[model samples]
Target: MMQTLPTLKKVTTTALVLLGLLTASCKTTPATQSPAQGALVSAQDSHIAYQGRIGHAGPDAAELYWSGTTIRLNFEGTTVKAWLKDESGDNYYNVIVDGDSLHLLRPDTTRRAYTLTYNLPEGKHTLELFKRTEYDRGKTQFYGFELGSDTKLLPPPAPQKRRIEFYGNSITAGYAVEDNSGKDQPDSTYTNHYLSYAALTARHFSAASHVICKSGIGVMVSWFPYTMPEIFDRLNPALPESKWDFTKYKPDIVVINLLQNDSWLVKRPEHDEFKRVFGTTPPSQEFIVNAYRSFVQQIRAKYPDAQIICMLGNMDITREGSPWPGYVQQAVAGMHDTKIHTLVVPYKNTPGHPDRQEQQQLANSLIRFIESNISW
Candidate 1:
């Protein structure tokens, strides 16, 4: 009783339509705000420079996000307020000022302005706001920043030389990397994409990073109904119909860490509960290899000149003689593409996913690989 592609498509379409209606109804009405103690700056103001996949950038507001996307501004002031549109309770962000320290902030389910900081000394400072939550949480719209009357915004920092894009599942999303609770567990409090291997690797190379990941998602199969191939191209991750133009931003390198979920789910015992959920038996080896190869080819088509690295492990898939890594290798070889390569990271993390320390180790290995194989 395998679900046919058309049946799956119909179900996905119906679900998306229902979700769209519900989201539209739940949209938080925008709130009016008096100008801050100083100058009122719109999102399009000269001082505010945004770096990431901005979905909608109007004169007054801009939708900013995708994990690791950042917005930066330099100003001379002791306090600043940001106007944001928050529709879900899951949107969280990190506000860093003058590189002093990290401050985590979560917006309420209301469209209004919020004070980012108000206790700094009255002097020149730099502020960077990063979306800590992944795409699945939803998008945040930034209306503008309000500064003290005497404060003035400055130009942004120089752009990074290299840029990398990561595609994968919860591991790439940095799920529970911070749990350190000494127990194998999954909790939102412990998930921090900022500390994931992709982000850390980008930091080591001083490169701009973009993380496109969803927990339980895989290249060939997923624990959920949707897979990466079905949603990776969406401009609005939550809205499947929103298509993202690939030419807008190009990465120098693309790292894909997928198939782990597929391995975990597809290898389930015949009597496993997932068999009833997925309505199909384990996919054949040929099917998995072909699916992976096709997905990589799709990426190659999008980024023809960029170097592609297919990575696996730091999970059960990394065990000796694991068929997971072999599938990736075979897929690469079948591509007949020199730019594609493979790396198998040993499983050295705790019982569950890799913790922060393990993420750092993986980042180090990836950095070494990039330095050796790629020009930048």
Candidate 2:
């Protein structure tokens, strides 16, 4: 006989208080409740854990995810389904089961339900579904998960203690890093956020990663109207009004990789367009330096204790003598903040951007830098 769980509406505060007491009492035991007791779990149920830049839009929908945001659940069953809402045809995800890569699914509809996995051996299993695309693809809402009658939700894995927040442009978003097509252009099929240096570095350090990035955005200027300064605080990347409450999540380390787009855009012949839009003439080196400094200060204001690393490219901002690297150094120095540091990686010389292989190298270099410098 299978237990029927309480519906979302029927779950009273008193019942929840009792359940919390029960959960606290059994710390050493598995967190799953007996499914035979007729306990139904809703999407908003406390047992279901979420990670990385996630925002709740409504009672049933989880929103504001960039690449690498994940939803996890532990349940004892042979099948599970996720009700996902992604209007864009380009949204994709990687499904992992019991620490194994299972399938890649493209939720190509406005609102559709997907069977994440099925027909597994009956026992406790874990599922991790990762969003594999960046914010530009579109936003996805996780309504909830559906488990089999015999199955019930278990406690999710313990959260990672070390957390890192990466802020940058397309390179940080892993834009076209996997393309290897030499076109120097972004293609949806070639973009894989999981392979980016930010993700790879997070995996190396066993840290929870939050990627706050967009393609072709910089501190002073962007390919589009908005720059990192204008949009970094938003809950939804697509909506300017959706402000993110920064206090909800804090990072031990904050890595800012701006300047690549700015470097290329500011120096180009059509730089007047930037001046027109930004209400300034061609940005001088001094203007860029001050802008970068201010942006770093903004991050400091948000994360007072975080170790800030200002980095510039495995792309155009190559070598020690470059003006771009100087700008980053000058920005950190001007702050007079000892907690902030700077790093510059060697150029990869890839056609479009650092491909997977190059990103791996960059990740390795960053890992070494962190290992040598930061105590963590």
Candidate 3:
């Protein structure tokens, strides 16, 4: 005959005891938390762990964050995620994950931070971040990267990243050089030269580079008709027409080669007006100098840690480069921990644009600098 076990309360007590016994008999361990716990982490009161200032004021300064010698991070799992912040307005970043290129997102007012969700594989992963100024292309201060949570571990086996960024003027835009050199047209513009130095550099370095250069723009100032100095002092002009977003498309390195057009000193209505104001025929060199300084300061304020490389291309717009180079050096000297480089490239056979040889020479100079200062 089947016998009744026990009363309701008695049965409950018995089940509890059995459960306790089973739990005790088996190994009790806490379940490991996934990397998602670090997601949506709060920004308030968060700190930037690896803040190293050793390379903050030199050619490698902008690259300080990614120099591998200074900045370091350890992760447990394969993938990782976090938000990036740069109060100094420095361009220092290179976060990749899971065979995907990380994005250099702009600050979202609604979100109140520049969020980055990187999916790194397992094991220990290295995140390299660096600076590249928007103007002058000079390398300066380099602050390390910030982390939301150091607790998150990389996966057992890590995933890899293959990305690059190209920053330059019309050359990077593939302006004028199309299909091939012989077939390209004048209207081709620098954009046609998609295979220009910037692009080729990215290719050589195996990076997904971002280009932010405009044809006639310069560091502290510009030429042609409107200069950054005159524009800022008199009127804040609208942004120029370009496909690449200045606020977006953050680049690892920026190459600048302006001043070609500035030396033009083209006679225009503005020149006549300037003569009336100064009681002279043309704008004085002092005016140009003042303008350049002011413009450079503004740029520095914008990208505090960017590694900027300023170049004097092969073509010599003004036979006498004394005024331009001297003014440039003076401006760079005033900035804190800035790297200023000058390249005296000779390219005159191609007429308006530098020929293939000239381009190669420019690339050689840049390559040497990158080899000495930055890592891919």
Q: Model-by-model lDDT, in order?
A: 0.74, 0.74, 0.38
lDDT tens readout by residue for model 3, 30-79: 22433233343221212222322222222211222211111223444433
Q: What lDDT is obtained when candidate 1 is compared to the true structure?
A: 0.74
lDDT assessment of candidate 3:
0.38
TM-scores of all models? 0.85, 0.86, 0.44
Poorest 10 consecutive residues by lDDT, candidate 3:
14-23
Please write out the lDDT profile of model 2 over residues 1-376, one tens digit for every residue.
2112221222112111001000111111122443332243445666677777787766656784687888888888766666666767677676777765435666655454566665677788888888878888888877666565567667767888999999988888788875656785665666777778998899888899888988888787777777899988988888889888999889999999888888777766466547655554577778888999999999999999999999877986774567888878987898898889998998876557888888888788888888988986
lDDT of 1 by residue, 1-376 (tens): 1111111112111111101001111122222332334666777655676766777755567886577778888887676767677667576676777765466666655655566656577677888788867776767888777775666666657778888888988888888787777674564556778788988898888888777888888886677667899988877777888888889779999999998888877767563435654456667788889999999999999999999999986888888878888888998999999899998999884588888888888888888898898897
- Runs of candidate 1 exceeding 4 Å displacement: 1-37, 57-59, 183-186, 269-279
Off by over 4 Å in 2: 1-41, 269-273, 277-280, 319-321
For TM-score, candidate 1 versus 2, the one ahead is 2
- Looking at model 2, which ten-residue stretch has the lowest summed lDDT? 17-26
Sort the candidates on TM-score, descending order.
2, 1, 3
